[model samples]
Target: MSRKKTTRHKAIIDQLSVNPSMRVSELSDALGVTTETIRRDLEELAAQQLINRTYGGALLRQPAEPVLSERHKANVEERAMIGKAAAPLLKGARILMMGSGATTVQVAKRIAFEMNNITVVTHSFGVATALSLNPTIEVVLAPGVYHAGEGAVHGAQTLRFLSDYSVDWAILGASGISPAGPTDALMDAAEVYACMLRQSSRHMIVADHSKFDRMATARFSQWQDIDVLVTDIAPQGPLGQALASGGVDIQLAG
Candidate 1:
């Protein structure tokens, strides 16, 4: 496709994400394109099963599973900053429960290199192995159904296993964060994180600024459930204001 067509395709997808359904005339006006051009884009997207074709434009398709490796590559510096800031909070904690994600992986790296004499209970195979590199930290693996792509485990077994232990803190990562609270793309993973939140004394969410104001398919916990939020930047706009008043303390890593 041409550069213009590629850009138009992305714009169409973005608009459809927010509105779900749109008309060709509306899309053309918004994108500053001719109606025929809009129609061609819609047709192409529909052919790819990225959208459901309607009379005029199209309806949004369900979002695909976000790849873990791709997520790990995105916002690298921001996640590292957030990780460094959050790792220090573990200084006095004896036991911790952590969820799996790129940000959390950064936290694990910090813990492995800096923190010591802490016990980590996690469903992430990668996290457990990472923490195990530090002889001072005791790593406990939660057994459950494995999600190979995510390098984590989630299901009834994981929840039941976590119930056997109480932790000083729960460090979680999210796909999206808003006034409504933290959300994840995967349902089973969300369930495991929800269990961790309930089983810990304090819940701290670690996410980058990009996650703010976004909505994910599955909401795992409410804003009130969060004790602290560690991120790369201070949130701005209405979502930021709402989060500030929503009771969770926000900490900027930058």
Candidate 2:
């Protein structure tokens, strides 16, 4: 796919993720493209199984979220910046339970490269492997049914395994962060992440600004439970108001 097509495809998926379903004309107007162009884009995205083509629009694929690997490729710079900004929050944290997501993987990589002598409790294969580069940091992989697409396991067994230990922090990434708070497209993550928040003393959510004002299939956290939010750009509009009202410390990565 061309770079333009890739960017547009990401936008389509992002839009569908926030709205659940979007009409062709709506997307065309929003994206500043012709209706026919929007139709063509929807058809291509559907063929890749990234979205479900409707009669005149599209819907987010049901049950599961988009492929993790594909997602990590979308907001590369933003994820990296958010990851860097979140690393310091882990400075005094001895043990942290982290969820599996694209941005969380970036956070793990940053932590491995910058921090040490810490223990990371997680079900994400990517997080564990990223932490392996720093021998001083212990990597504890939670046991569960493995998923090839996510390269992680955030399911019933993973939740059970993590419930046994109380950690210094629960650091996670979200599919969407709206006025209501953090949400996830994957049910496995939606449930397991809430458990993580309960099992830890502090909670931090890492997401790019693209997720601002977006809502997803399931909510993983309440506004009162969140300690901090790290993102590339400062959230504005209703998202900004909500974060402020919730007393969440917003950190912008430069």
Candidate 3:
């Protein structure tokens, strides 16, 4: 690719990383290129399995996690407030399990800073590493194939390891949530979360406002399965009403 084309490719991927879906015209306008050029770039990206071409746009591949460096850029304050709110709930718990994602990492940071003598079991390398900074916290990593982009482990081995230990609390994250409940963009991550839910005595999902009403590739659990939800904003609309009626406790950080 020429220098200019390379620059456009980088910009396109960066935009998709943040929004997940975008149209050719949007890319064209954003990149200062013709629609035809943007379409060609989208086709190239799709062929490389970096994105999925749609009718008028492209979306991030279903199984792919956003580059970790970019994940933290989307929702900063909301995630932090959520972490602070969630930390107190696990205050007395001895054994805690954390799932992978930016919000969950924030929770781990709060747990490490505010709590003491906690044992954290997780497949998320980010969670484990963050908690390890506190000597009072013991971090146990579940074994599995590593997904570097996600900074987590997931596979049959990880599931088996998680099944062996029941934690006092499970702090989880999600790619999307609907009235049907929390779903994940990737099946492997969803499967691991299902195990995490089962192997823990209590569990909750920590996500930001953006997750509401979005649908991912797989639904991991029903609304009634998890005990609580921590988010920046209270969900709205009919789906929100349905989730509210479903009996899971909803806690808003903001």
Give the number of the best model, judged by TM-score: 1
Deviation in angstroms for 103 in model 1? 0.7
Estimated TM-score for each candidate: 0.76, 0.75, 0.75
Runs with alpha carbons beyond 4 Å of true place in candidate 2: 1-64
Residue pairs in clash, model 2: none
TM-score (C-alpha, index-matched) for candidate 3: 0.75
Q: Rank the candidates by TM-score, best first.
A: 1, 2, 3
How many residue pairs clash in each candidate at the backbone level?
0, 0, 0
The root-mean-square deviation over C-alpha atoms between each candidate and the true structure, in angstroms, is: 6.5, 7.8, 7.4
**Tens digit per residue, CA lDDT, model 2, 135-183:** 9999999988887887888667888888998999999999877777798
Candidate 3 lDDT tens digits, 6-52: 88888998887776656688888888989999999999987877776
Q: 57-111 in candidate 1: lDDT tens per residue?
A: 6656545546777888899999899989988877799999999998898889888
lDDT score, candidate 1: 0.84
RMSD of 3: 7.4
Per-candidate local distance difference test: 0.84, 0.84, 0.84
